[model samples]
Target: MTDTLETQPLDRAPATPEDLFAFLDAHGIRTTTVSHPPLFTVEDSKALRGELPGGHCKNLFLKDKKNRLWLVVALEDTAVDLKTLDRRIGSARLSFGRPELLWETLGVRPGAVTPFSVLNDREHLVTVVLERAMTAHELLNYHPLINDRTTAIRSADLLRFLRATGHEPEIVDLGPPSGS
Candidate 1:
């Protein structure tokens, strides 16, 4: 599938953080952002985020055996076992997608992956999966397509934004880590 935004020129540059915020505003998805030290891992976020409240998330850009791309967003603490996640999500084997594919499909690099990047995926080439537990929180947090800032939005607004981008995300109960 040609995974390019239909409304934008093929030569258009990847969306920037500013573009992401503008798109969110255009959609009326209320959000709040805070700038902080660049965070490259969940541990970095925990150390620097001090008092931010919400279900902070980790986004995994994955590719299935069939070459299908997936964006799995789960709580920062969720122990996502790739060995077993495929069965629950109805896919063949799953592996982390490469950085090139991530940039091509979602317009973000590792350490900055966010569901918000789906705005660049106008063709719906990526399957978004939200952890059921994460959605139970009143608010969710993720990078605004960058690692130096975090943005919080209501869980419902997240669903609204994803749908507005033509990605009907799959909310799956990924369950406790194996041997819990």
Candidate 2:
């Protein structure tokens, strides 16, 4: 008899918020999600922060001079020197990626960018940058593929999930460059 069962391709289909939860469960990563009004800015999210314990993140979807893409996940209060960030990540020069590209590559809108979105990047086109300090925290919070909710998970589990999605992120000290 021939083996006829075919496994589904993991990266072919875009992942939705629901899919993200299933992915987390499959990886045995425990998470807590809190629902609230859509948050587009850090200030807007502040109201919900008090209820959640852990480090909150602000994710940036950026592109380099060569058109290489990067997803930067940093602590909400961390001061990121964009002009000097390229030196650490080794990108030509960096600027926020176009909204269209962000959606297409990460399957998220502007306010919804999160490291979890790497699951939608079947081609693994976007490089992930994680702030070292942020990862040191016990728990980290980010949107679960959507802006209307926040999901909190163990910092280490976040890395595990990213690796499971084929994105071995570059964990760097996001401290401002010395000369900056």
Candidate 3:
């Protein structure tokens, strides 16, 4: 049974940056990309944002106490109080996933993790978390799959891409409650 599944044409192919872009285009989701030096951290990509018009992102690959994995995509400037983040996402405590596991599950290096990596998650093991504030933005930017380039897409298109990949994201307000 496993062998038959592996040979099926419907099975997902190994994901690549080019494949990601093609997938985006095929869905009628337009995006613009720029090539630059590799950027692995939010701070590293700051300067490049000058030429890009969008909400730059800080993507986090996290794991919970029960080993459930999550990929959080939030505005780069959003304050992340990790201590309180699990409550917002319904996890029993969360910590950054190790680099090895990041590559193993998302098929990307630590610095290059993006929501797009979910394409490689054929097992659907990773749950995506999108910040509410980020959803308010018209445009958002993240690495396509590699850290050497950035791709800007409409925020709605992001949700579309995630759904298309069979990973419907959990949108949450990562910040403190409005009244609090």
Candidate 4:
């Protein structure tokens, strides 16, 4: 008898932004996707920053006791004290969103959280919080709805994605860097 061969079918659909460049292209949104080993933290994002093009961001999801969800996007190098951010965002206390909440709300993992995930926010329940300083930059980068890959996109195009996703973002001043 001939040897039998077994292959594993893809466990997950190639629906995430990383796997679907055509989605953005269809919308006339041009971007560059770069594959990195895997980065879980901003410091980690920083490590691979040189290899990637465009500015990077750190994303945070917070909730108020009332069950209100907030998405915070900030410059990767900026130091934000969540304790202080709590007041700015008008929340009880700012903390990382539970893994379940992340999946439920954005259909993403803890380390893979990105504003792009907002596409899955069907209810439009999450309010985006952006750093006012971001407007000064022409481009911003983040995971492509998946951490395995990073996408460098025009800041304007990102806004287009948010709008198409039905997300209204709030811009706030982050004051100054921790020591500054």
Among these predictions, the greatest lDDT belongs to 1
Q: What value does the lDDT take at residue 164 in candidate 2?
A: 95
Using all chains and alpha carbons, the TM-scores for the candidates as numbered come to 0.92, 0.89, 0.88, 0.83
Q: Residue 97 error for model 3, in Å?
A: 0.4
- Candidate 2 C-alpha lDDT tens digits along 1-180: 011101223335568889999999999999999989899998889875567999988999998877788999999888888899999888889999878777767878888889999989877888999999999999999999889999999999999999999999999999952354
lDDT of 1 by residue, 1-180 (tens): 333321234245779989988988999988999999899999999999989989988999998888788999998878999999999999989999888788777778789999999988876889999999999999999999989999999999999999999999999998874356
The numbered model that scores best in TM-score is 1
For candidate 2, the 10 contiguous residues with the lowest summed lDDT are: 1-10
Report, for every candidate in turn, its global Cα lDDT versus the true structure.
Answer: 0.88, 0.86, 0.84, 0.74
Give candidates' CA RMSD values in order: 3.4, 7.3, 5.1, 9.4
lDDT of 2: 0.86
Per-residue CA lDDT of model 3 for 58-176, tens digit only, reads 99998887778889889888887779989889987998988777777788888898998998888888899999999898999989999999999999999999999999899998884
lDDT, residue 53, model 3: 88
**Native-referenced Cα lDDT, model 3:** 0.84
Model 2 lDDT at residue 15:
84
Clashes per model (N, Cα, C within 3 A): 0, 0, 0, 0
- The regions of model 1 sitting more than 4 angstroms off are 1-11, 177-180
**TM-score, structure 1 vs. true:** 0.92
